[model samples]
Target: MPTLYLLKTFSDSTFSLDVLIGEDDMTEHVDVVVAGGGPVGLMLAVELRLAGVAVTVLERRTDIDPTIKAGSLNSPTIQALYRRGMLPELEAARDENMRQFAAFAAQRSGGGGPAIPRFAGHFGGVMLDRDTIDQDDPVLVEQAHLGTLGLVSQQQFESMLERRARDLGVDVRRGVTLTGFHDTGDGVTVDTDSGTVTAGWLVGCDGGRSLVRKQAGFDFPGTAPEITAYQAMATLRGTEALEVGWHVTDTGVYAYGPHPGRILVAEFDGAPRDRTEPVTPAELQAAVRRVTGVDVGVDAITSATRFTDNARQATEYRKGRVLLAGDAAHVHSPFGGQGLNLGVGDAVNLGWKLAATVRGWAPDGLLDTYTAERHPVGEWVLDWTRAQIAIMRPDPHARAIRAVVADLASRGDGATYLATRISGVWQRYDLPGEHPLVGRSAPDLAFADGSRLADHLHDGRALLVDLRDDAGLRRSADGYADRLTVLTATADDTDLRALLVRPDGYVAWAATDAADTGPDKYLGLWLGAPVGD
Candidate 1:
């Protein structure tokens, strides 16, 4: 017997349990085997354990990637981190960047004028301001982080999530690769770089070219590359003539930097360069010259990488017992830095459903919703990227359309819509409910004591909040015990008498008229087997 640990701390508490690992005809077995121990895979592991399932995460690299491939984390992602209690330290480090942006916005707007996107985001090359966005006050972040589009290097963000996942006792195996997997229908036998392990499910959190997706024969079809995009960080001098924002040149589109040390160069080269090979300093310098028509001096190139709008997606998120998440399921242009945010969103949405399936309480077709919900969202993101690429084309039609959008983006409503879409604020599911908040992210409703709704969901269980403290509703929740948590609070607002919230902080049900329609209806629909089953 091996002592398997559960995520006891940072949630309810950290603890370990005894379980059989090696059994007859096998090396070890877990309820879930996750390939590619990046942000998404690790997040899924934590979600599974929160539901009391054993999970093992296998990653290809021995260490975190040094490349800062992603540079932005959006609002939804910030909320996810806050839910997991991993936001404070990262927020602490983000102070300087926030201050810099704040100062820049003040200077640009003559010191606090009309609202903008709080942080600078872009569509194509056009800037989208957060202050201009028409949204409720942010519910997911602290007061200091409100309305501010904050930036954290990919390295810092991934390291934090990885640490948080490990603290939850997830078995994250590094330097391990998944060579193959067989979905025997009942379960999956996965062969990895280390050895073979069997599990009830297998998920590939690997990158775009996913072995699991390839071996499982998931159909991935989409547009090819429009252009090769290059991002570089280097030591440079004597290039002040280079513009600080996106530029559509006669030749191609290029952006110099908000950071004086960095530069972005895009060439309308039909095919993207081979990213497998390391980007050379000479290559980066040459790219700079080609885009800017400037023989800029480069002291040294710290990092260089290339990407394309070669978007593709899996026709299905899962095949039999094999599933996919993150880049394995979809790949897109890195425009607006949605790649990481989208992958993290996938992990959060799929986590609880998959865990329920493994724990044997998943209602019929519960796991299937993973694809149903994410695939469309993935499609939307791909089109969003494609739309950006459309306007960046160096042609009369593209230039004219770009001009019209730029003008429209200045309108309050237009900017708000763009900001909301870019921040993923409008993302809502069509669940079985009529309540307006049912399919949307639950408002961080404040209690009379100032404690917000998320305070009760750290345990990753469904929450039944009774503002009126009605005995019937209270008893209704008590039936589910650990699966359903009941909270008694005088609401910070009096709009609703009570509500039910899922672990992901979405409202499952709510009652505004003080009528207790029996919490069992919604509870069973979501958590299975109602109370006192």
Candidate 2:
């Protein structure tokens, strides 16, 4: 029998309990143990708890770090949050941030001038023209009300997620770090610094340097880093040395910012020798001068960090009882602001499916669909970042291609393409369906009561939209009531007779006429056989 250790701290004292592995009576159990209580982990925890699954999140940090990471939310991410009843809060937060930014910009411009343009988004350093996007496109039209872009700090976003997780009664344990874990053929015995937890599933949302991914032996393969980038908040002696906004210079690419002291510089001088080393003022000044070809002196610094274009992704998101999400599963350049949105998407997609599996009602191969649906998205993000890096290279060929891309980006179709990818609205899983909207994110269909389809999904259940209020369709869906919600609402689009939407807000089945395919097969395929079957 193996001896497992559990540590407990009482005030100033620490103690341990050594129990034999077979002694199940002494062990703590949970449905899932999520390592790393970042936004992704907390989001997953909330999703699990919403479905009544017992979840325990282990976070190394005692508190949320107020770091400026991802600064915007894409369209699909916005839609996902909206489905969870977070749209109002999201808008409030974005508005507050925008106000602060506006004040800052005003003060910088002497408090009296034409207002700066609101940021749409960017691909590489090329600015996307929002005015040029094709709003008539179905994809863009669906996302219009949701707003294709939302500006919010990652710290604020994580805080919101943490609050939601706690509200959902998720057992979030702070100051606990997952050191290692082993699959015991049934459940995962998670070893954290604080104690041991026996959970049916273990998920790693532990960022790029993930111990779970390495220890669980998940194969992560992709391109290596080519450039070392630095984002810092520091006082500069010569403020006029660099201009605000992104600049692709002969040496490398650099971006001064909307914020007074914020600066970001990227050099194609290979990866940093030691990314772990603390960035010093002297180092930052040198990099700034190198990239901008100007003598700028970094006097004082508040915070600084190094990043690379080192893109890598786990071929599989799961191995037995262990799984990975967010940066743990895939990492790439942060140029397009895709990381957070992608991770949030992963959490939403995996959440209900995992919850169903835990509750013992999931259809065959339900959990397997998580990777099948998400891995392609991750692959595309990796390639997307790589493409940006190609355009950012300082060589002559790269500059020529950059010009061409910039020109294309100025056009309606090109801008729409870029916006669609950046906003993540273009994401559509290849599900078994002929309808164009089948695998796409469901539109926010309106009802007679004025409540949108998103309002019906707040409880975290698959939805059966009965457009005709068909008594027969309602009767047919009665058997699967436990796993889904059947809403008898009038559709705004006359062509959409009825549709079955998954818990993640993707259309699973649709019908344009009475003769069209019914929801029975898709419901069975997704929600499993109805009760008493």
Candidate 3:
């Protein structure tokens, strides 16, 4: 039997663990333990550290890969990254031609209209050329030319994130794979390849195959057997322009795009195929040639891996002292490039909440809101990606529907809707009540003080912008100065008081009404508190 070590915090928080070193045994205790050191995990660690929480990250991989897997970032994700001060570096390192555009192709469907669909507006997808439009983006043009999308490889992103985490006083240990975890009612004892460690709280930031989620006995409910996907990074010998093109042929569905000096091609199969069955360079070259009718020599092959698009979302993100974020919470197809973006968004959403929980200022139910808020978004992404994959299938019904949708997509409203869906701006968290602004992200509003609603969130604190006319309420709010910021604006003032903003930039409790709903109720709910509590 392994010797069990018990650790206690100053606040009476205690953790117990059985330490084991192969056949021998030793144990150590910690405050919070995070599994995985990928981008999502590292981002969570950094966010927690910034919030003054102590965390330790365990990573199995020794290095990151240089090849870009996720090709582009949407505007909402750009804003989230900007909040973390990572936008500058990412923008600087992204491929230059990162402007969004739609592509239209014509094909004949047996049912009707043009066989090829016409797509317009931003729904078409952004072209990240990595050569031209990189410097013009306002966020990240100044950092050393890393690679478009900010850092060149997964390893480099991890390296930079590790440096940032260290700057914020986080303990990151690499080459440590989690083997097993035990929840001893008080805390969790995590058994890793390196050693056994105990912590008051544990977060699973590991990828789709999350060991932490499994250890917690949380069920990932959804479709199983996993849909497979094939991805490869290959250099196109004679292409300088980077553009994403969609080609629909009777034989199959194929898409190609310029990536750095190479081009990436994706083929969807109705059935699973062995990823390591051995693929020749000539085979890939031939596929590209078949799709584009352009013979671009394959100078080099970076990586070819097979992955599944498992549409499974963890039944719950939080289970006792352990929590899950990013891919650990949800897994879906890579259609519309939603996986990485959604994962990063999850990190941003959970980061502040975790920090508040650690700091002891968080309300009782605030932490639980992570699952309440993100689970639906994850489910939505999975459904949408599945639809996208279905669209690429060679079935007659799918083909006909694609044709109809493509034709409908040519219109302004259809194009706008598609753009919103692809850009991820259409997502909104569920808020109670029938208020017009509730559940919708508050639009940026200009104020007389030269401040924007988003600007107030820089300190990572909840904000209460009083748009009501009662001067006495503002005076009374001064009593709770430390917990909330009171900004006064006249009802007639179109500039500042036009909207009441929530911390996450959503209009949680907003009104143009001069009538007082009582600041306490509004503020309490936005602060994740129940009325009169």
Model 2 spans with C-alpha error above 4 angstroms? 1-26, 111-115
Cα lDDT of all candidates, in order?
0.77, 0.85, 0.62
Off by over 4 Å in 1: 1-26, 96-119, 130-149
Candidate 2 on 1-533: residue-level lDDT in tens? 77555544322121122233433334567789899899899999988888888888999999986545787888877888889999878988888877877775775577343334554677888887677888898777877887623787788889888888988777898998888999997999998776678889999999999999999999999998999999888887675656656779999999776666788899998888998888899999999999999888999888788899999999999999998999999999898789998999999999999999998889999999999999999999999999999999999999999999999999998988888788888899999988888998888888889899999999889999998878877787878877889888886666888889999999999888888877888888999988898
How far residue 464's Cα lies from its native spot in candidate 1, in Å, is 1.0
lDDT of 1 by residue, 1-533 (tens): 76453432222243333333333332567788889887788778878777777788998899987764777787777777666666575676477566665564454356233322434578888876556655553422322333443477677777877787778778888987788888999999898767788888998898898999999999999998878877887887656466566777866778755544567877777766577898777777787888788778777877778878889999999899989999999998888888888998888888898887877677788888889888988999999999999888888999899998888787777876787777786787778887777877777777888777777777788889888878988977755785778888897545788889887777889888755366678888888885456
TM-score of each: 0.89, 0.93, 0.76
How many clashing residue pairs, candidate 1? 15
Which stretches of candidate 3 lie above 4 Å from their native place?
Answer: 1-28, 94-163, 224-228, 237-244, 266-272, 275-299, 449-451, 466-503, 526-533
What lDDT tens digits, residue by residue, belong to model 3 across residues 1-533?
Answer: 77554443332122222333344544666667889888788888876765566678998877665545665665556555554566556654453333321111111122232322222222112212223222343223322222334223344455667788877667788777889898887789889877788887889989888988887888988775333444567655644222344555554444554333334444444335665575457776775555445666876677655555568888899988889998898887665667777887787778777776766657678888888998889888888877766665556987887777776565545554565566566777887645666776655444556765556655445566665455666654544444456666433334333344554556666655556354556555545443233
Ranking by lDDT: 2, 1, 3
Checking candidate 2 for backbone clashes, the offending pairs are none
Report the Cα lDDT for candidate 1.
0.77
Comparing 1 and 2 on TM-score, the stronger one:
2
